[model samples]
Target: MTYRIEVDQEICVSSGRCVAEYPERFRFDDEEVAEGVPGAPPLPDDATLRLARACPSGALLVFDAQSGDEIDIFGT
Candidate 1:
């Protein structure tokens, strides 16, 4: 199960909640602002959802690369 996380940079508000809560999967650079952690491996189910939930704009998106299905962490 290959997993990947992506964010809509245009919609991001730079609140930094996601980075603060899940630094393992997120980073806050002063110039670049907050972004998904680069070069990180696929995350366990729970950790993935935690990072999603921490996102304020729901800008974070998770998907199964093989299935091409959105990882419905919010069940929305």
Candidate 2:
């Protein structure tokens, strides 16, 4: 199953927790736009949830690519 991650720019506070936690799967640009795509090694794992849970601004989002089923790691 393919999956993706989207960050809410409005709520993201430039916290690099996700990046630090899941460097392979999560990334942020200078604009602090977090993105998640399928990849290998160091890819996002349950640890991503930890980062998401820790993010005070609540920006992390996980979605199943085929089903569009979403998990608000940060809790909407």
lDDT per residue as tens, model 1, 2-74 = 6677777777788887777767877866665677777866677677777777778887888887887988877
Residue-by-residue lDDT tens digits, candidate 2, 1-76:
4445567877787777777766776677767766654564433456555665777777766677679898755454
- Model 1 Cα displacement at 5 (Å)? 1.6
User: Model 2 — TM-score against the truth?
Assistant: 0.58
lDDT of 1: 0.75
Q: lDDT for each of the candidates? A: 0.75, 0.65
Clashing pairs in 2: none
| Cα shift from native, residue 4, model 2 (Å) | 3.3
Q: Alpha-carbon error at 73 in model 1, in Å? A: 2.5
After superposition, candidate 2 runs with Cα above 4 Å error: 1-3, 37-45, 72-76
